[model samples]
Every structure is written in structure tokens, then in C-alpha cells.
Target: MQIGFFAVGIGPSADPEIIALTARTAEQAGFHSLWAPEHVVLIDQYASRYPYSQDGKLPMSTKVDILDPFVALTFAAAHTKTIRLGTGICLVPERSPVVTAKEIASLDKLSGGRFDFGVGVGWLAEEFTAVGVPWERRAERTREYLKAMKLLWTEEEPQFTGEFCSFPKVRLYPKPVQKPHPPILFGGESTPALKRVAEVGDGWFGVNVTVEDAKAKIERIRSYAQAAGRDPGKFRFMVSPGLGLPVELDMIKRYRDAGVHQVALGAIPRDAKGIKGEIERLAEKLVVPAAKL
Candidate 1:
């Protein structure tokens, strides 16, 4: 199984020099990809609980500096050659579909076709309100937005009309190097999320699922794919464990046994020094040995 570092791209470690160093080190260490999370804006308090944590609270402080995933990945792209860059979870429903399509395509073009678009219908209601996006029917909007983006990516003079998005026939230049756009990995654990993946996603980015549960979920996704007349063999399954979970070789093996194609480990550090140390430790102790096994 491939291993990736899930960098928050926030807090003290978000400096440009640190991000560049992390990208270079991870690529040199033979890590598969580097992922960054997205949050356009954060408020001091939120009614929505973070879904990944046991206490439903975010691990980082609200004061932490959050960077735009695309911008952050762009910085990392300039610093590394082969390590794939991904938005761990871009909030799709909050942004304009046309602009996002251009950003995804541009990033994929610039990154030599090594972009993974991991997306989700966001959970922060207050943030949605702040962005003037209605909280209700967000999943539906996300689906429409993705469909719209796909049209923009694949067609020469694409036009789309939907409940949330409408556009006239127009040519979008510099189509992604990867045909039909980048690998779109949907993130979430609900049945609806899995169904969405079967319908449109190239993969599932399941969050915080244990090994035993992930096996069942992977089977379930395959079943859904089959029912939808999609080839289950073509889909990728990836898991990102909860923050603070023990990440040992045995745990990695469990995920591999569960049919996961990749595992993303959170590599948050307090400062630039810690960032380098954490990447080195994970590379030497887990990623390198795991690859040989």
C-alpha cells in the first residue's frame, strides 16, 4: 500500500520554506503524496462538531493559520518533482463550480498530471452562512457542482445548467494533462457518500475508519459500484486515520489487508523543526520499511 503525509497547512508549520522543505523531504523519502486540508474561513466557535475526532472537536485551535489548499499545493509543487499533491478535502459546495474547475485543471496541468482532488460537502454551517451558501441541500449542490466541473473539463465548448450552477457554452483553455481531469476522491462515510462515489468519484477517501470497519465499507462500496454498473476493480480505496492514532507497521498492514490502496497519516508538527523531524521519523520508521514488506 502507498503511504502519504496529511499536512494541515496551518499553524506555525505553514511557512513557505517549511512547506517546500517538507515536500522535498517527503518526495526524497519516497512518499506517494502530500495532502493539505481546506477551509476558506474559520470562526472562533462552531456548532458543527468535527466528524473525525472522538469528542467531535477540531484538533487545532481556531486561531491557527489555514491556507488555501490549491495555493498551498502550488507551493509544494514547485518544491518537489514526483510526490503527488492533493487537497485532502476541498469544500466543494462553498465555491463557484466554474472557478474551481479552472483551478483543478490548472493545478493538474502545472503539476504534470499529479493532482488528486479529494472533495466533500463541508460540515461547517456557520462557514457556509458566512460564504452565503445555504446549508440545506448542500449534498445536492455538491453533486451538481462536480457534474458541472466535469463538463467544463471534458468538453470543448462546455455548457451546464443545474439547480445551483448555470453556464453558457464557453471554451475553457489548458485542459488538464490527465485526460478527463484529475482523480476525484470523495471523502465521507455515509451511504449517500458511497453512492456518490460509485456514481462519479474515481475513489473513496474514507476518514477515521478502523481496519475492520474499512474492510466492510470497501466491500459495500464495491457492491454499490456493481449495482451502478461501474467496474469495482477500477476504484481506489484510501483511509486517513484520526489524528493521534498510533501509526505503526502493523496498523499499516491491517489497512493493506482491508484492501486499502493508500493510507494517509496526519503529520502535524508545532514548528518547522518538528515538521522536518516528523517527516524523517515517519519515512525512516514506517514508510521505508512498509514498502519493503
Candidate 2:
């Protein structure tokens, strides 16, 4: 089972030095990947309820200097060689897909084909409205935009036509280093999200699910994929069990038995000052021993 690190990478204490240090250490420690979520701008009043939290309140960390995922990942990419970078989940419907495809494909080219595009339809209604994107038709828009992005990445002279976007054949220089474009992992626990995974995604990324709960979800996902004539075994499972206890070996075994491909440690640092030390401690204590099993 592969292990990864999930970090917010914001706040007063998360300076460049700290981030660099963490990235270097995580690479040295043999962590599989590093993931960070994105929020271009946080909105206070949104009609949609925040899904992760019980109270529908966004975390205070969202209000911090949360660096843009691409820019920050580029900086980290310059600093590390082997450690892959991913958006734990990027809110795609809120941004222009053309712009996003260009940026991410460039990053993938620069990183030597080490990029995973994790996407979601977004939860903040006000953020979508602020960006002039309708929240109601986000799913349809997302599908169209992603299809357009694929055309841009794969076709020499790409063109796209859809309700949300249409473009004439155009050349995008420095096509992605990855052959078919970066692997996309769909994030969310909803039925539509599962269907999206079956149709378009390379993997299903689960959040806040225990091993037992995840097994059921994975089975459901596989059923959907099979129904769509997709090979269920081709779909990877990447889990981020947020705000949880230290991952035990037993938990790791459970996930492995249930066919989880990777697990990102979502236990966050309570003290930003000690984030590095905390991560090192967890890696040494939990991950190292489990890898041997």
C-alpha cells in the first residue's frame, strides 16, 4: 500500500523554508505523493453546504494565505525530483478549463510526467457565482470542460464544441510529457461523483471514509464502472481520512485487503511550528513499519 501526505500548506507558520523542508523530508522518507487542496478565494455566504464538516462551516485554514496549488507545486517541483505532486482535489467548474489544462499540462511536462489531476465540482456557491459560473449546471459544464481539456492535451490541432465551450483547431505548444495527459482522480462520495469516476476518471478519491465504509463505496464504484464497461481493476483508490487518529497497521491492512491503492495521512499539524517534526514522527512511527508488512 502506498502512503502519501496531505497538507493544507497555509497559515503564518508555513513559510517557504518550512514547506521546502517538509517536501525534502517527505521525499527522503519515501512518501509516494504529496497533495494539497485549492481555494482561489473563500466566500463567507454560499448557498451550498460545505460537505466535509458536520456544521457546514469551512475550516479557518481556508481563510489563510493558501497558496495557489499550481504555483506552489511548481515551486516544490523545482525543489524535489521523485516526489509526485497532486491537487488533493482542484475545484474545476469554477475556473476556465482551457487555462487549467494549459497550466497543468505545462506542470506535467516540467515535472517529467509526474502529475495527477484530482477534480471536483466545488461546494461554494458564492465562489462559483463570483466567477460568473452557474452552480446549478456545474456537472454538465465540468464534463464539457474536461472533454475539451483532453482534446487540447491529446490532439495536435485540437478543437471542441459544447454548450459551455467551443473552439477552433488550435495548437498548444509543449504538449504534456505524459502520453495521454495526467491521470484524473474524481473526488467526492455522491452517486454522480461515482458515475463520473466510472465514465471519465482514472481513480476514485475518497475523503472521511473509514476502511469498512470505503469497502462498500469501492464496491459500489466498481459496480458502476463495470456497468459502464470500464475495467474496475484499472481504477485506483486514493483515500484521505481527514482529522483522524494515527493510521494503525491494522487500519493499513484493512485498506489493503479492501483494495485501496494509496492512503494519504490526513492527520494535520496542530502546531505549524512543529509540522515537520510531527510529519517525520508519523512517517517513522506509522508508515515505515506498515510498509514492511
Candidate 3:
């Protein structure tokens, strides 16, 4: 099992010096990847349900400092040599597909093809409303956007005409260094989310699930993949055992045994000093054991 981290590039890690230190720390510590979450805007209060929290509220307040995932990852890419980087979940429907594609391709090219695109048709309806995106048919919008982006990355002379996105033939230069494109890891645990991954995702970024839940979800996703005529063997399964899970060797082993390619620990303390300390500790306690697994 590859040990990675979720909730990177938030709070103090948004600072340039701190991001350099944190990114290099993870790379040197043998972590597999550093994944950052995205929320373009946050309101003090919103009615949208936060699926991970019991009270249907976000863990963060509007004052929390969160960097744009692409910018944050690009900064980390410049600061590190080998540790992989990902958008733990970029809100796909909230951004333009053509612009988003350029950002992903640019990041991949700049990062030497080390980027993973973990995306979601976001849940916060209020945020969507704030961004002027319709709250309805978001899943369909995400699917169409991804199709358009894929064409941009893979085709030399690309053109896409879809219900949500359309563009004329154009030369998209600096194509992603990754062949075709970087891995598209769909995020979420909903049935539609799993089915969406089966249809288009290169992987699944399951959030806030335990080892047992991870196992069952992976199996279910595989079934969905088979039903969709996709090869489950080609898909990567990445899980984030929530903050409450024990980050012990035995726990890591159980996740590995569950066929998880990578297991991500939840966000650490938000301060730069705290972030650095926690990652170093997790490196010793989790990365070493996971590598042996």
C-alpha cells in the first residue's frame, strides 16, 4: 500500500516557504502523493449538506485559507522531485472544461506528468449558486466537461461539441507529459459516483471510509466497472481513512489487504509548523510500514 496525504495546500501550507518545506518533507519522507482539496469560495453558512459530517456542515469556516489546487500543486511540483500530486477533489462543474483542461495539462507538463486529476460534481448547492453554476444536472455537466477535456489532451487537433461544452478545432500545445493525460480519479461514494467512475475514471478517490468500507466499495466499483465493460484490473483504488482511523501498521496492512493501491491519511494540523511535524511523524509511522506492505 502506498501511503499518501489528503488535505494538503490548505491553511499555512498556502505560504510559499511553508509549501516548499512541506512538499519536500513528504517527498523525502517516502510518501506516495500529496493531495489537495478545492473550494473556490466558502460562505459563513450554507444549507448544502456536507456528506462527511454528521451535522451537515463543513468542517471549515469561511475564514480558512485554501489555495487553488492547480496553483498549489504547481508550486509543490516546483519544490519537489518525485512525490506525486493530486487535486483530492476539484469541483469540475464549477469551472470551464477548456480552461480546466489547460490548467491540468499545464500542471502535468510542468510537474513532469506527476499530476492526478481527482474531480467531483460538487455537493454544495449554495457554493454552486454563488459561482453562478446551475445546481441541477451537475453530474451530467461533469461527464461532458471531462469528455471535452480528454479530447483537448489526447487529440492533436481537437474539437468538441457537446450539450455543455463545444469548441472548434484548435492546437492545444504543451500537451500533458503523461501519455493521453494524467489519471482521472473520480471522487465520492455515491452510487452515481461509482457508476461515473466505472464509465470514465481511471481510478476512484474514496473519501472518509474505513478499511472494511473501502473493501466493500472497491468490490462494488469493480462490479460497476464490469457492468460498464471497463477493465477493473486497470483501475486504481485510493482510500482516505478518515481522521478518526488509527494510523498504525496493522491498520495500514488491512487497507493493503483490501486491495487499495494507496491509502491517504486525513488532514493534519493547519499551521505550517504543525503540518511539518505531523507529516514527519506520519512518514515514520505510516510510510515505512506501507512500503513494506
Candidate 4:
């Protein structure tokens, strides 16, 4: 099992220097990855429910100071050599695929092939509207955007023609360091999302599901993969622990047994000493002996 940390990167609580230090230290401490969440801006009166929480509320802290994920990851990548840099979930439909693909590919090139592109179709209606995207067609748009991105990543003189996007053949420079592009981990729990992951993505990045349910979800995802003519074994399973603080090693082990390849604990407090202590604590309790146990 690969143990990792996920930070929201709230500006006041998380400084760039501290974020970089945390990434470096996580690498030194034998952690597998460091993930961050995205929110370009937050509107208090969102007309959508936050999927993970019972209340449809965005955390006030997150809304107040969320930093841009790509820039933060770029900063963290500079300070760490081995730890993989990831987005817990970048909402893709909000931005143009061509530009987003270029940025992500650039990051992969700059990071020496250590970028994991975890993505989602976002739940907040206000957010999609704010970005000038149609909320009703988010799922379809997400699918098309990902399909378009795949073309951008793998093709030479890539061209895409679709309902939402169209472009003539154009070459994307500084092709990703990772062959065939960086690993794409799609985030969502719905059937449509799972099907999308099975058909196009390299992995499933799920949120808010417990291990017991995750086991069932993985089985369903495998079924979808099979139906999509994909080999299920090639797809990775990654989870972001929402609302929960640090989880127990035994619980981590249980999730592994249930088919989780990577586990990331989110919303960690960002004080340096406190963050270091938390990292060491998780390493001692979960990661260091995770495989042996």
C-alpha cells in the first residue's frame, strides 16, 4: 500500500515555503505522494451540495484561502525529487482542455514525469456557471474533455473535433516526460464517472467512501473496465480520506485488502512543526511498515 498526504493549500494556513518543505520532508520520510485540491474561487451561496458532506457546505477555510493547485504543485515539485505531485481532484470542465492539457503536460515535463492528474466533473453548479460552463452537460462535457485531452497527450500534431471543442492539427511542444503522458486518475463515485475512468482514465480517484463500500465500488469499476474492453489490472485505485483526520494503519491495511492502491489523508493542518509531527506520526503508524504488515 502507498501512503500519502493531501493538503487543501489554504493560503493563510499553508505558505509556499512550508508547502515545499512538507513535500521534501514527505519524500525523505518515505511517503509515496503529496496531493492538493483545487478551487479558483469560492462563492458562499453555492447552489449545489458538496458531495462528501451531509450538509451542502464548502468548508469555510477552504473557501477563504484555496490556492491555485497547478502553481502550488509546481512549487512543491521544485523542492522534492521523488515524491509524486498530484491534484486530489482538478475540476476539468471548468477550463479549456487545450490549455489545461498544455499546463498539465508542462508540469509532467518539468517534474521529471512525477505528475498524477487526478480529475473530476465538479459538483458545484455555481462553480461551473462561474467558469461559464454549462452545468447540465457537465458529465458529457467532462467525457469529451478527457477524450480530447487523451488526443492531446498521445498524438503528434494532435487535432480534435467534437461538439464542445474543435481545432486544427497543432503540435504541443515539450511533450510530457512520461511516455503516453502522465497517469490520469479520474475522481468520482457515480456510475458515469466510473465508466469514464474504465474507458479512458488510468485510475479511479474516489472520495468519501469507506473501505467496505470501496471494495464493492472497485468491483463495479472492474466490470465497467471489462465492458469497455480494458484490462482491470491496469487501472489503479486511489482514495482521498475526506473529513477524517489520520486513519489507523489497520484501517489502511484493510483498505489495501479491499483493493486500494494509494491512500491520501486530506485537509491536514499546515503549521511546519505540526505538519512534520503529523507526517512522522503517520509514517510510524501506517506507512513505514505498511507492506510488511
TM-score to true structure, per model: 0.97, 0.94, 0.97, 0.95
Q: Indicate the TM-score of model 3.
A: 0.97
* Candidate 2 minimal-lDDT segment of 10 residues: 8-17
In order, the Cα lDDT scores of the candidates are 0.88, 0.81, 0.87, 0.82
* Candidate whose lDDT is highest: 1
> Which candidate would rank higher by lDDT, 1 or 4?
1
Clash count in backbone of candidate 3 = 0
Which lDDT tens digits does candidate 3 get at residues 151-211?
9999999998999889999888789999879999998898999889989999999888888
> Which candidate would rank higher by lDDT, 2 or 4?
4
By descending TM-score, how would the candidates be arranged?
1, 3, 4, 2
lDDT of 1 by residue, 1-293 (tens): 79888884777657887888888988998789999988888878888988877788877778888899999998899888899999989999999999999998989888899999999998789899999999999999999999999999999999988899999999987899898789999998889988899888999998889999899989988999999999999999889887657789999998998999898975676777887888888888889977876
Candidate 4 TM-score versus the reference: 0.95
For candidate 4, what is the total of clashing residue pairs? 0
TM-score for candidate 1: 0.97
Query: lDDT tens string, model 2, 36-69?
Result: 7788788766667888888988867446777788
1 or 2: which has the higher TM-score? Answer: 1
The lDDT, on a scale of 0 to 1, for candidate 1 is: 0.88
Task: Give the CA lDDT, 0 to 100, for residue 167 in model 1.
Answer: 94
Ranking by lDDT: 1, 3, 4, 2
Candidate 3: regions farther than 4 A off: none
